[model samples]
Structure formats: structure tokens, C-alpha cells
Target: MSGKTISELTNEELLDKRKKAKNANIISAVLIGFFVGIAVFSAIKKGLGFFTFFPLIFVFMLMRNQSEAKELDKEIKSRNLHF
Candidate 1:
């Protein structure tokens, strides 16, 4: 199929896609952990919240990435501005 890859998207779209992907990835990871925790506990394991860490880490990374992307986009647009 002919579709824009991450690199092919515009800066704003790229940032938005990254944010969405990060969030979804984090959520999926957390869910996997939850299910894993359940399975482990069901088989002589202990309780832990380790999986919750994914969301926190993702939020921080996503924020930073988004900010950087915005800055880069601004810089590019400024340079390309016609006066």
C-alpha cells in the first residue's frame, strides 16, 4: 500500500502520531503486565505494580519528544519563511 511512513509525515502529523503511538504502546504494555501479573499470581507468584511504570515513563518521553518535534518544526518553518 502507498501510505506515508512516520518520516514522510509532516512535522505536526509526525509529532501527533508519535504521541498516539507512545500512549497506545504504553497502554498495551501495561495491559500485558496486568495479565502477566494475574497469570503469575495464579501460579504461585506475588503481587507487584512493576507494569505501571511503563505509563509513567511513556508520558515523560512522549512529552519530551513532542516538545522537541514542535521546536524542530518551528525552526524549519522559520527558515523556510519567505519575506
Candidate 2:
């Protein structure tokens, strides 16, 4: 995260950041689903072992991106901002 506070950002900057954060979250979710699907297929073809870890990693990443999106949402809300 940057040291700059959300208050320091202009409205356009804030909206852009929010849009990027939302896009990142959406991408992360899609990746998570893709990884999970692969993990399931791997489990079905080959026994579970290291292959299972990939989906877990994706899940963690998804959670992180979701948190980031939530933080952006909070900032937008605090400023009563709209895009």
C-alpha cells in the first residue's frame, strides 16, 4: 500500500483507483475459479498432493484482492464519492 492517504487523492484519481481495484478483484475471482477448476480436475486424475496448494494460493490471493477492494470502497464511502 502507498503511504498517501485517500484524502490526498483528487476525485478523478480516487475514482480511477476504485475502478482499478474493482477490476483487480474481478480478475482475482475469475482466476480463483479457474484454479479451483484445475485443482478439481487434477484431483480427479491424480491423487492430491502439491497440486492442491495452487488453489489455496489462489484463494489467499482472492481474499487479499477482496480486502483491497473493500478498503477502496471504504475510502470512497468516507468521502461520499461517486464515479
**Where does candidate 2 have its weakest 10-residue lDDT segment?**
61-70
Give the per-residue lDDT of model 2 (tens digit) for 1-83: 27777778777888998888878877877888898888888888897978866787868867865776677778889889885
The number of clashing residue pairs in model 2 is 0
Q: Each candidate: RMSD to true structure?
A: 9.1, 2.1
Q: What lDDT tens digits, residue by residue, belong to model 1 across residues 1-83? A: 14864345665665565466557666766765666555556555434455444445555554454554454455446546321
Residue 73 displacement (Å), model 1: 15
Candidate achieving the largest lDDT: 2
Model 1 regions lying over 4 Å from their true place = 45-83
Q: CA lDDT, every prediction?
A: 0.54, 0.79
Write down the lDDT that model 1 would get: 0.54
Candidate 2 structure, TM-score to reference: 0.80
Which portions of model 2 show Cα errors greater than 4 Å? 1-3
- Candidate 2 structure lDDT: 0.79
Per-candidate total of colliding backbone pairs: 0, 0
